[model samples]
Target chain A: MVIINGEEQNAAGLTVAEVLARGDYNAARVAVEKNGLLVPKREFGGAVVSDGDVLEIVAFFGGG
Target chain B: MIPAKEEMLAALKERIGGDLLEKFQSSAAAVCGLGGLGSNIAVSLARAGVGRLFLYDFDDVDVTNLNRQQYKASQIGMSKADALRENLLEIAPYTEIISQKVKITEDNALPLLKDADVICEAFDKAESKAMLCNLVLEKLPEKYLVAASGLSGLGTGNSILTRRVSERFYICGDGESDVDTCGTLFAPRVCLCASHQALAALRILAGLYDV
Candidate 1:
Protein backbone atom coordinates (compact mmCIF):
# COMPACT_ATOMS: atom_id res chain seq x y z
CA MET A 1 0.00 0.00 0.00
CA VAL A 2 1.08 3.53 -0.75
CA ILE A 3 0.44 6.33 1.72
CA ILE A 4 -1.42 9.31 0.20
CA ASN A 5 -2.21 12.35 2.28
CA GLY A 6 -1.79 10.25 5.45
CA GLU A 7 -4.09 7.44 4.25
CA GLU A 8 -3.06 3.96 3.16
CA GLN A 9 -4.11 2.99 -0.36
CA ASN A 10 -3.50 0.04 -2.67
CA ALA A 11 -1.79 2.04 -5.40
CA ALA A 12 1.70 0.57 -5.55
CA GLY A 13 1.66 -0.23 -9.29
CA LEU A 14 -0.11 2.85 -10.69
CA THR A 15 1.38 6.04 -11.99
CA VAL A 16 1.09 9.15 -9.85
CA ALA A 17 -1.47 10.54 -12.26
CA GLU A 18 -3.55 7.38 -12.06
CA VAL A 19 -3.51 7.37 -8.30
CA LEU A 20 -4.59 11.02 -8.10
CA ALA A 21 -7.33 10.46 -10.74
CA ARG A 22 -8.87 7.76 -8.59
CA GLY A 23 -9.36 10.27 -5.81
CA ASP A 24 -11.01 12.80 -8.16
CA TYR A 25 -8.14 15.19 -7.67
CA ASN A 26 -7.82 17.85 -10.32
CA ALA A 27 -4.40 17.33 -11.94
CA ALA A 28 -4.01 20.90 -13.10
CA ARG A 29 -4.80 22.34 -9.68
CA VAL A 30 -2.72 20.04 -7.53
CA ALA A 31 0.99 19.64 -6.76
CA VAL A 32 2.33 16.22 -5.87
CA GLU A 33 5.21 15.11 -3.73
CA LYS A 34 6.41 11.51 -4.09
CA ASN A 35 8.38 9.81 -1.34
CA GLY A 36 9.60 13.20 -0.02
CA LEU A 37 10.33 14.47 -3.55
CA LEU A 38 8.16 16.77 -5.63
CA VAL A 39 6.89 15.28 -8.88
CA PRO A 40 6.82 18.02 -11.51
CA LYS A 41 3.64 18.44 -13.55
CA ARG A 42 5.10 16.82 -16.64
CA GLU A 43 6.53 13.88 -14.70
CA PHE A 44 3.30 12.91 -12.98
CA GLY A 45 2.41 10.62 -15.85
CA GLY A 46 5.72 8.78 -15.74
CA ALA A 47 6.20 8.62 -12.00
CA VAL A 48 4.96 5.35 -10.55
CA VAL A 49 4.31 4.50 -6.92
CA SER A 50 5.90 1.70 -4.92
CA ASP A 51 4.89 -0.10 -1.78
CA GLY A 52 5.10 2.12 1.31
CA ASP A 53 5.76 5.26 -0.78
CA VAL A 54 4.25 8.46 0.51
CA LEU A 55 2.46 11.01 -1.66
CA GLU A 56 1.40 14.46 -0.61
CA ILE A 57 -0.98 16.33 -2.92
CA VAL A 58 -2.29 19.84 -2.38
CA ALA A 59 -4.85 21.23 -4.82
CA PHE A 60 -5.26 24.90 -5.66
CA PHE A 61 -8.43 26.80 -6.55
CA GLY A 62 -9.38 30.23 -7.88
CA GLY A 63 -10.56 33.40 -6.10
CA GLY A 64 -7.53 34.28 -4.00
CA MET B 1 -1.34 65.15 13.43
CA ILE B 2 -0.45 61.49 13.18
CA PRO B 3 2.13 60.11 15.56
CA ALA B 4 5.67 59.87 14.25
CA LYS B 5 6.89 56.45 13.13
CA GLU B 6 9.08 55.95 16.19
CA GLU B 7 6.38 56.80 18.73
CA MET B 8 3.78 54.70 16.99
CA LEU B 9 6.18 51.78 16.75
CA ALA B 10 7.05 52.29 20.38
CA ALA B 11 3.42 51.93 21.39
CA LEU B 12 3.21 48.92 19.09
CA LYS B 13 6.29 47.47 20.76
CA GLU B 14 4.76 48.01 24.16
CA ARG B 15 1.56 46.32 23.11
CA ILE B 16 3.09 43.20 21.54
CA GLY B 17 6.23 43.08 23.67
CA GLY B 18 9.72 44.12 22.55
CA ASP B 19 11.07 40.72 21.50
CA LEU B 20 8.16 40.05 19.14
CA LEU B 21 8.16 43.59 17.87
CA GLU B 22 11.89 43.31 17.24
CA LYS B 23 11.42 40.03 15.44
CA PHE B 24 8.63 41.53 13.31
CA GLN B 25 10.64 44.66 12.59
CA SER B 26 13.52 42.49 11.42
CA SER B 27 11.60 40.01 9.26
CA ALA B 28 10.64 40.35 5.60
CA ALA B 29 7.73 38.78 3.71
CA ALA B 30 6.52 38.82 0.11
CA VAL B 31 2.93 38.80 -1.14
CA CYS B 32 2.65 37.47 -4.70
CA GLY B 33 -0.78 38.86 -5.58
CA LEU B 34 -2.42 42.21 -4.76
CA GLY B 35 -6.11 41.37 -4.81
CA GLY B 36 -8.39 40.40 -1.94
CA LEU B 37 -6.01 37.90 -0.39
CA GLY B 38 -2.80 39.65 -1.24
CA SER B 39 -4.01 43.13 -0.30
CA ASN B 40 -5.22 42.03 3.11
CA ILE B 41 -2.17 39.80 3.60
CA ALA B 42 0.10 42.76 2.90
CA VAL B 43 -1.87 44.95 5.29
CA SER B 44 -1.62 42.44 8.12
CA LEU B 45 2.11 42.05 7.65
CA ALA B 46 2.47 45.84 7.71
CA ARG B 47 0.29 46.23 10.79
CA ALA B 48 2.47 43.70 12.59
CA GLY B 49 5.44 45.94 11.75
CA VAL B 50 7.25 43.53 9.47
CA GLY B 51 10.50 45.19 8.45
CA ARG B 52 9.84 45.01 4.71
CA LEU B 53 7.22 43.71 2.30
CA PHE B 54 7.51 42.91 -1.40
CA LEU B 55 4.19 43.38 -3.25
CA TYR B 56 3.79 41.92 -6.76
CA ASP B 57 0.91 42.56 -9.16
CA PHE B 58 0.52 43.70 -12.74
CA ASP B 59 -3.15 44.67 -12.92
CA ASP B 60 -4.93 47.93 -12.18
CA VAL B 61 -7.33 48.34 -9.28
CA ASP B 62 -10.67 47.99 -11.05
CA VAL B 63 -14.09 48.72 -9.59
CA THR B 64 -14.75 45.01 -9.38
CA ASN B 65 -11.85 44.54 -7.01
CA LEU B 66 -13.17 47.10 -4.55
CA ASN B 67 -15.59 44.64 -2.97
CA ARG B 68 -12.91 42.54 -1.28
CA GLN B 69 -9.61 44.27 -1.96
CA GLN B 70 -8.13 46.92 0.32
CA TYR B 71 -7.83 49.45 -2.53
CA LYS B 72 -9.84 52.66 -2.45
CA ALA B 73 -12.44 53.45 -5.10
CA SER B 74 -10.49 56.53 -6.20
CA GLN B 75 -7.40 54.40 -6.84
CA ILE B 76 -9.16 52.46 -9.58
CA GLY B 77 -6.79 53.44 -12.38
CA MET B 78 -3.64 52.95 -10.33
CA SER B 79 -1.47 49.87 -10.47
CA LYS B 80 -2.22 47.35 -7.76
CA ALA B 81 1.38 47.32 -6.51
CA ASP B 82 1.60 51.10 -6.22
CA ALA B 83 -1.92 51.48 -4.89
CA LEU B 84 -1.37 48.85 -2.20
CA ARG B 85 1.92 50.45 -1.24
CA GLU B 86 0.17 53.79 -0.76
CA ASN B 87 -2.37 52.22 1.60
CA LEU B 88 0.28 50.19 3.43
CA LEU B 89 2.40 53.28 4.00
CA GLU B 90 -0.43 54.93 5.89
CA ILE B 91 -1.07 51.79 7.93
CA ALA B 92 2.55 51.06 8.83
CA PRO B 93 4.82 53.89 7.76
CA TYR B 94 7.91 52.22 9.16
CA THR B 95 7.39 49.05 7.09
CA GLU B 96 9.42 49.36 3.92
CA ILE B 97 7.17 48.39 1.02
CA ILE B 98 8.59 47.41 -2.33
CA SER B 99 5.94 47.45 -5.05
CA GLN B 100 6.93 45.30 -8.00
CA LYS B 101 4.58 45.82 -10.93
CA VAL B 102 5.06 42.49 -12.64
CA LYS B 103 3.45 39.10 -12.99
CA ILE B 104 5.29 36.25 -11.28
CA THR B 105 6.15 33.61 -13.84
CA GLU B 106 8.40 30.55 -13.88
CA ASP B 107 11.34 32.57 -15.17
CA ASN B 108 11.22 35.37 -12.61
CA ALA B 109 9.67 33.48 -9.71
CA LEU B 110 12.85 32.27 -8.03
CA PRO B 111 14.77 35.51 -8.31
CA LEU B 112 11.87 37.66 -7.21
CA LEU B 113 10.99 35.53 -4.18
CA LYS B 114 14.49 34.59 -3.01
CA ASP B 115 14.84 37.42 -0.52
CA ALA B 116 11.77 36.96 1.60
CA ASP B 117 11.86 35.06 4.90
CA VAL B 118 8.40 33.76 4.04
CA ILE B 119 6.49 33.85 0.76
CA CYS B 120 2.69 34.10 0.66
CA GLU B 121 0.95 32.93 -2.53
CA ALA B 122 -2.29 34.92 -2.86
CA PHE B 123 -2.92 34.88 -6.60
CA ASP B 124 -6.53 34.98 -7.82
CA LYS B 125 -6.25 32.21 -10.42
CA ALA B 126 -5.67 28.52 -9.99
CA GLU B 127 -3.08 28.33 -12.73
CA SER B 128 -1.07 31.18 -11.25
CA LYS B 129 -1.32 29.67 -7.80
CA ALA B 130 -0.13 26.29 -9.01
CA MET B 131 2.67 27.86 -11.00
CA LEU B 132 4.04 29.76 -8.03
CA CYS B 133 3.57 26.99 -5.47
CA ASN B 134 5.07 24.24 -7.61
CA LEU B 135 8.10 26.26 -8.59
CA VAL B 136 8.74 27.39 -5.06
CA LEU B 137 8.41 23.92 -3.58
CA GLU B 138 10.66 22.37 -6.20
CA LYS B 139 13.32 25.03 -6.64
CA LEU B 140 13.26 27.10 -3.46
CA PRO B 141 12.62 24.39 -0.94
CA GLU B 142 14.36 26.24 1.85
CA LYS B 143 12.09 29.29 1.98
CA TYR B 144 8.76 29.01 3.76
CA LEU B 145 5.67 29.17 1.50
CA VAL B 146 2.09 29.82 2.65
CA ALA B 147 -0.45 29.39 -0.18
CA ALA B 148 -4.26 29.60 -0.39
CA SER B 149 -6.89 27.57 -2.24
CA GLY B 150 -10.59 26.54 -2.04
CA LEU B 151 -11.64 29.93 -0.63
CA SER B 152 -14.46 30.63 -3.01
CA GLY B 153 -18.16 31.39 -2.43
CA LEU B 154 -19.93 31.46 0.93
CA GLY B 155 -18.63 28.36 2.57
CA THR B 156 -18.40 28.22 6.36
CA GLY B 157 -15.51 30.20 7.82
CA ASN B 158 -14.58 27.17 9.89
CA SER B 159 -13.73 25.28 6.68
CA ILE B 160 -10.89 27.64 5.89
CA LEU B 161 -7.68 26.69 7.67
CA THR B 162 -3.93 26.48 7.37
CA ARG B 163 -2.48 23.07 6.59
CA ARG B 164 1.15 22.18 6.83
CA VAL B 165 2.02 20.19 3.74
CA SER B 166 5.69 19.77 4.49
CA GLU B 167 8.46 21.19 6.62
CA ARG B 168 8.57 24.43 4.63
CA PHE B 169 5.34 24.41 2.61
CA TYR B 170 1.96 25.38 4.08
CA ILE B 171 -1.42 25.85 2.38
CA CYS B 172 -4.38 27.82 3.78
CA GLY B 173 -7.91 27.15 2.48
CA ASP B 174 -10.81 24.73 2.55
CA GLY B 175 -9.18 22.22 0.13
CA GLU B 176 -12.56 21.58 -1.50
CA SER B 177 -14.56 24.54 -2.88
CA ASP B 178 -13.70 26.19 -6.18
CA VAL B 179 -14.85 29.54 -7.53
CA ASP B 180 -15.81 28.03 -10.88
CA THR B 181 -18.80 26.35 -9.25
CA CYS B 182 -19.04 28.24 -5.98
CA GLY B 183 -20.10 31.57 -7.58
CA THR B 184 -18.62 34.96 -6.72
CA LEU B 185 -16.02 35.25 -3.96
CA PHE B 186 -17.38 36.84 -0.81
CA ALA B 187 -15.45 39.44 1.20
CA PRO B 188 -15.53 37.74 4.61
CA ARG B 189 -14.47 34.37 3.22
CA VAL B 190 -11.59 35.80 1.22
CA CYS B 191 -10.52 37.90 4.17
CA LEU B 192 -10.57 34.82 6.36
CA CYS B 193 -8.18 33.02 4.06
CA ALA B 194 -6.02 36.12 3.80
CA SER B 195 -5.90 36.36 7.55
CA HIS B 196 -4.82 32.74 7.70
CA GLN B 197 -1.95 33.50 5.37
CA ALA B 198 -1.02 36.59 7.36
CA LEU B 199 -1.11 34.78 10.69
CA ALA B 200 0.73 31.82 9.24
CA ALA B 201 3.46 34.09 7.97
CA LEU B 202 3.74 35.76 11.36
CA ARG B 203 3.99 32.43 13.12
CA ILE B 204 6.72 31.39 10.71
CA LEU B 205 8.52 34.63 11.52
CA ALA B 206 8.22 33.93 15.23
CA GLY B 207 9.32 30.27 14.91
CA LEU B 208 5.78 29.00 15.52
CA TYR B 209 5.19 26.66 12.57
CA ASP B 210 2.39 24.28 13.39
CA VAL B 211 -0.74 24.44 11.20
Candidate 2:
Protein backbone atom coordinates (compact mmCIF):
# COMPACT_ATOMS: atom_id res chain seq x y z
CA MET A 1 0.00 0.00 0.00
CA VAL A 2 1.09 3.55 -0.65
CA ILE A 3 0.39 6.39 1.72
CA ILE A 4 -0.99 9.38 -0.14
CA ASN A 5 -1.79 12.58 1.67
CA GLY A 6 -1.52 10.57 4.90
CA GLU A 7 -4.09 8.01 3.75
CA GLU A 8 -3.17 4.44 2.87
CA GLN A 9 -3.91 3.31 -0.66
CA ASN A 10 -3.46 0.08 -2.59
CA ALA A 11 -1.33 1.78 -5.18
CA ALA A 12 1.92 -0.16 -5.17
CA GLY A 13 3.69 -0.02 -8.55
CA LEU A 14 1.11 2.41 -9.95
CA THR A 15 2.26 5.54 -11.68
CA VAL A 16 1.70 8.99 -10.17
CA ALA A 17 -0.58 9.75 -13.06
CA GLU A 18 -2.78 6.82 -12.14
CA VAL A 19 -2.80 7.88 -8.50
CA LEU A 20 -3.71 11.42 -9.43
CA ALA A 21 -6.39 10.13 -11.76
CA ARG A 22 -7.83 7.97 -9.01
CA GLY A 23 -7.88 10.87 -6.60
CA ASP A 24 -9.46 13.18 -9.18
CA TYR A 25 -6.92 15.89 -8.47
CA ASN A 26 -6.45 18.58 -11.07
CA ALA A 27 -3.03 17.68 -12.37
CA ALA A 28 -2.35 21.17 -13.63
CA ARG A 29 -2.93 22.74 -10.25
CA VAL A 30 -0.93 20.53 -7.95
CA ALA A 31 2.62 19.84 -6.81
CA VAL A 32 3.42 16.26 -5.85
CA GLU A 33 5.92 15.00 -3.36
CA LYS A 34 7.16 11.43 -3.23
CA ASN A 35 8.38 10.38 0.15
CA GLY A 36 9.87 13.81 1.12
CA LEU A 37 11.27 14.68 -2.30
CA LEU A 38 9.41 16.89 -4.70
CA VAL A 39 8.38 15.15 -7.97
CA PRO A 40 8.39 17.63 -10.79
CA LYS A 41 5.28 17.77 -12.98
CA ARG A 42 7.10 16.30 -15.96
CA GLU A 43 8.04 13.15 -14.05
CA PHE A 44 4.54 12.33 -12.83
CA GLY A 45 3.78 9.99 -15.69
CA GLY A 46 6.98 7.99 -15.49
CA ALA A 47 7.37 7.83 -11.73
CA VAL A 48 5.81 4.78 -10.11
CA VAL A 49 4.59 4.30 -6.57
CA SER A 50 5.99 1.58 -4.38
CA ASP A 51 4.82 -0.04 -1.18
CA GLY A 52 5.14 1.86 2.10
CA ASP A 53 5.91 5.09 0.23
CA VAL A 54 4.51 8.40 1.42
CA LEU A 55 3.17 11.07 -0.85
CA GLU A 56 2.05 14.62 -0.20
CA ILE A 57 0.15 16.63 -2.78
CA VAL A 58 -0.53 20.35 -2.61
CA ALA A 59 -3.04 22.06 -4.86
CA PHE A 60 -2.66 25.59 -6.18
CA PHE A 61 -5.42 27.83 -7.44
CA GLY A 62 -5.59 31.08 -9.36
CA GLY A 63 -5.99 34.56 -7.85
CA GLY A 64 -3.75 36.52 -5.49
CA MET B 1 5.40 64.04 9.45
CA ILE B 2 2.45 62.42 11.19
CA PRO B 3 4.37 61.79 14.41
CA ALA B 4 7.91 61.50 15.71
CA LYS B 5 9.66 58.14 15.47
CA GLU B 6 9.77 57.78 19.25
CA GLU B 7 6.11 58.72 19.55
CA MET B 8 5.05 56.15 16.98
CA LEU B 9 7.11 53.45 18.64
CA ALA B 10 5.61 54.35 22.01
CA ALA B 11 2.08 54.05 20.59
CA LEU B 12 2.87 50.71 18.95
CA LYS B 13 4.45 49.46 22.14
CA GLU B 14 1.40 50.46 24.09
CA ARG B 15 -0.88 48.52 21.78
CA ILE B 16 1.14 45.35 21.08
CA GLY B 17 3.56 45.39 24.03
CA GLY B 18 7.18 46.40 23.69
CA ASP B 19 8.73 42.94 23.39
CA LEU B 20 6.47 41.63 20.63
CA LEU B 21 6.53 44.99 18.84
CA GLU B 22 10.28 44.91 18.85
CA LYS B 23 10.26 41.46 17.31
CA PHE B 24 7.81 42.67 14.71
CA GLN B 25 9.87 45.73 13.95
CA SER B 26 13.20 43.88 13.72
CA SER B 27 12.32 41.22 11.12
CA ALA B 28 11.75 41.48 7.38
CA ALA B 29 9.02 39.95 5.19
CA ALA B 30 9.24 39.35 1.44
CA VAL B 31 6.08 39.82 -0.59
CA CYS B 32 6.64 38.02 -3.91
CA GLY B 33 3.65 39.34 -5.84
CA LEU B 34 2.47 42.88 -5.17
CA GLY B 35 -1.10 42.13 -6.21
CA GLY B 36 -4.14 42.00 -3.98
CA LEU B 37 -2.76 39.51 -1.45
CA GLY B 38 0.78 40.87 -1.40
CA SER B 39 -0.35 44.47 -1.14
CA ASN B 40 -2.63 43.75 1.80
CA ILE B 41 -0.01 41.64 3.55
CA ALA B 42 2.60 44.37 3.07
CA VAL B 43 0.23 46.98 4.49
CA SER B 44 -0.45 44.98 7.66
CA LEU B 45 3.23 44.24 8.23
CA ALA B 46 4.12 47.88 7.60
CA ARG B 47 1.50 49.14 10.06
CA ALA B 48 2.98 46.78 12.64
CA GLY B 49 6.36 48.33 11.74
CA VAL B 50 8.14 45.34 10.23
CA GLY B 51 11.73 46.58 9.86
CA ARG B 52 11.96 45.90 6.12
CA LEU B 53 9.73 44.80 3.25
CA PHE B 54 11.04 43.24 0.01
CA LEU B 55 8.25 43.84 -2.46
CA TYR B 56 8.78 42.02 -5.77
CA ASP B 57 6.50 42.24 -8.76
CA PHE B 58 7.10 42.58 -12.51
CA ASP B 59 3.66 43.76 -13.56
CA ASP B 60 2.27 47.24 -13.91
CA VAL B 61 -1.00 48.30 -12.30
CA ASP B 62 -3.72 47.70 -14.84
CA VAL B 63 -7.14 49.37 -14.93
CA THR B 64 -8.82 46.03 -14.22
CA ASN B 65 -6.78 45.39 -11.07
CA LEU B 66 -8.21 48.51 -9.42
CA ASN B 67 -11.19 46.45 -8.28
CA ARG B 68 -9.31 44.17 -5.90
CA GLN B 69 -5.71 45.50 -5.74
CA GLN B 70 -4.45 48.43 -3.69
CA TYR B 71 -3.23 50.56 -6.60
CA LYS B 72 -4.72 54.06 -7.03
CA ALA B 73 -6.39 55.43 -10.16
CA SER B 74 -3.57 57.82 -10.83
CA GLN B 75 -0.96 55.07 -10.61
CA ILE B 76 -2.56 52.91 -13.27
CA GLY B 77 0.53 52.33 -15.39
CA MET B 78 3.04 52.33 -12.54
CA SER B 79 4.92 49.16 -11.69
CA LYS B 80 3.36 47.37 -8.73
CA ALA B 81 6.56 47.26 -6.72
CA ASP B 82 7.29 50.95 -7.16
CA ALA B 83 3.70 52.01 -6.60
CA LEU B 84 3.30 49.92 -3.48
CA ARG B 85 6.61 51.21 -2.16
CA GLU B 86 5.44 54.77 -2.58
CA ASN B 87 2.14 54.06 -0.82
CA LEU B 88 3.69 52.05 2.03
CA LEU B 89 6.34 54.69 2.71
CA GLU B 90 3.58 57.23 3.22
CA ILE B 91 2.03 55.03 5.90
CA ALA B 92 5.19 53.85 7.65
CA PRO B 93 8.09 56.01 6.64
CA TYR B 94 10.47 54.29 8.99
CA THR B 95 9.71 50.81 7.69
CA GLU B 96 12.28 50.21 4.96
CA ILE B 97 10.49 49.37 1.71
CA ILE B 98 12.62 47.74 -0.98
CA SER B 99 10.76 47.25 -4.23
CA GLN B 100 12.06 45.06 -7.07
CA LYS B 101 10.38 44.95 -10.45
CA VAL B 102 11.49 41.46 -11.35
CA LYS B 103 9.90 38.06 -11.71
CA ILE B 104 10.82 35.25 -9.33
CA THR B 105 11.95 31.88 -10.57
CA GLU B 106 13.50 28.78 -9.09
CA ASP B 107 17.01 29.93 -10.01
CA ASN B 108 16.80 33.30 -8.22
CA ALA B 109 14.26 32.41 -5.53
CA LEU B 110 16.77 31.50 -2.86
CA PRO B 111 19.03 34.52 -3.29
CA LEU B 112 16.05 36.86 -3.64
CA LEU B 113 14.60 35.70 -0.31
CA LYS B 114 17.85 35.23 1.54
CA ASP B 115 17.37 38.10 3.97
CA ALA B 116 13.67 37.66 4.65
CA ASP B 117 12.61 35.99 7.86
CA VAL B 118 9.21 35.28 6.35
CA ILE B 119 8.10 35.10 2.71
CA CYS B 120 4.60 35.72 1.40
CA GLU B 121 3.64 33.93 -1.87
CA ALA B 122 0.90 36.02 -3.41
CA PHE B 123 1.19 35.15 -7.09
CA ASP B 124 -1.84 35.30 -9.37
CA LYS B 125 -1.29 31.96 -11.08
CA ALA B 126 -1.29 28.40 -9.89
CA GLU B 127 1.95 27.59 -11.67
CA SER B 128 3.75 30.55 -10.14
CA LYS B 129 2.42 29.75 -6.69
CA ALA B 130 3.45 26.12 -6.97
CA MET B 131 6.86 27.04 -8.32
CA LEU B 132 7.61 29.48 -5.51
CA CYS B 133 6.24 27.24 -2.79
CA ASN B 134 8.12 24.22 -4.06
CA LEU B 135 11.32 26.20 -4.47
CA VAL B 136 11.11 27.74 -1.01
CA LEU B 137 10.17 24.46 0.59
CA GLU B 138 13.17 22.80 -0.98
CA LYS B 139 15.84 25.50 -1.20
CA LEU B 140 15.09 28.07 1.50
CA PRO B 141 14.45 25.79 4.40
CA GLU B 142 15.25 28.39 7.07
CA LYS B 143 12.62 30.94 6.06
CA TYR B 144 8.90 30.78 6.68
CA LEU B 145 6.57 30.86 3.65
CA VAL B 146 2.97 32.05 3.95
CA ALA B 147 1.20 31.08 0.72
CA ALA B 148 -2.33 31.52 -0.58
CA SER B 149 -4.16 28.91 -2.63
CA GLY B 150 -7.74 28.45 -3.82
CA LEU B 151 -8.66 32.00 -2.82
CA SER B 152 -10.86 32.89 -5.75
CA GLY B 153 -14.61 33.44 -5.86
CA LEU B 154 -17.07 34.88 -3.32
CA GLY B 155 -16.76 32.16 -0.79
CA THR B 156 -17.62 32.49 2.89
CA GLY B 157 -15.08 34.60 4.74
CA ASN B 158 -14.68 32.04 7.51
CA SER B 159 -13.66 29.40 5.00
CA ILE B 160 -10.50 31.31 4.19
CA LEU B 161 -8.11 30.08 6.86
CA THR B 162 -4.44 29.74 7.71
CA ARG B 163 -3.14 26.19 8.02
CA ARG B 164 0.35 25.30 9.13
CA VAL B 165 1.30 22.85 6.40
CA SER B 166 4.75 22.22 7.81
CA GLU B 167 7.19 23.59 10.33
CA ARG B 168 8.07 26.47 8.03
CA PHE B 169 5.25 26.55 5.44
CA TYR B 170 1.79 27.97 6.06
CA ILE B 171 -1.06 28.00 3.56
CA CYS B 172 -3.92 30.48 3.84
CA GLY B 173 -7.03 29.95 1.72
CA ASP B 174 -10.11 27.80 1.26
CA GLY B 175 -8.05 25.18 -0.64
CA GLU B 176 -10.90 24.63 -3.09
CA SER B 177 -12.25 27.73 -4.78
CA ASP B 178 -10.36 28.32 -8.04
CA VAL B 179 -10.89 31.31 -10.26
CA ASP B 180 -11.16 29.07 -13.32
CA THR B 181 -14.48 27.69 -12.08
CA CYS B 182 -15.57 30.58 -9.90
CA GLY B 183 -15.57 33.07 -12.80
CA THR B 184 -14.84 36.00 -10.50
CA LEU B 185 -12.41 37.29 -7.95
CA PHE B 186 -13.88 39.91 -5.66
CA ALA B 187 -11.98 42.34 -3.48
CA PRO B 188 -13.59 41.23 -0.23
CA ARG B 189 -12.72 37.54 -0.62
CA VAL B 190 -9.24 38.27 -1.94
CA CYS B 191 -8.57 40.59 0.97
CA LEU B 192 -9.76 37.91 3.37
CA CYS B 193 -7.06 35.56 2.14
CA ALA B 194 -4.55 38.39 2.23
CA SER B 195 -5.39 39.04 5.88
CA HIS B 196 -4.79 35.41 6.67
CA GLN B 197 -1.37 35.49 4.99
CA ALA B 198 -0.53 38.76 6.74
CA LEU B 199 -1.45 37.47 10.17
CA ALA B 200 0.49 34.28 9.67
CA ALA B 201 3.58 36.20 8.52
CA LEU B 202 3.30 38.63 11.43
CA ARG B 203 2.87 35.80 13.89
CA ILE B 204 5.97 34.12 12.56
CA LEU B 205 7.88 37.40 12.69
CA ALA B 206 6.80 37.83 16.31
CA GLY B 207 8.16 34.35 17.17
CA LEU B 208 4.65 33.01 17.64
CA TYR B 209 4.27 30.31 14.99
CA ASP B 210 1.40 28.13 16.15
CA VAL B 211 -1.36 29.13 13.78
For every prediction, compared with the true complex, DockQ reads 0.83, 0.66
lDDT (C-alpha, whole model) for all candidates: 0.91, 0.88
Best candidate according to lDDT: 1
As for candidate 2, its clashing pairs are: none
TM-score of chain B of each: 0.98, 0.97
Q: List the candidates' TM-scores in order.
A: 0.97, 0.91
Stretches of model 2 off by over 4 angstroms after superposition: A15-17, A26-28, A34-54
lDDT for predicted candidate 1 compared with the true structure: 0.91
> Candidate 1 residues B53-154, lDDT tens each?
999998999999998999999999999999999998888877888888998999988888888999999998898998898999889988999999988898
Q: Which candidate ranks first by DockQ, i.e. highest?
A: 1
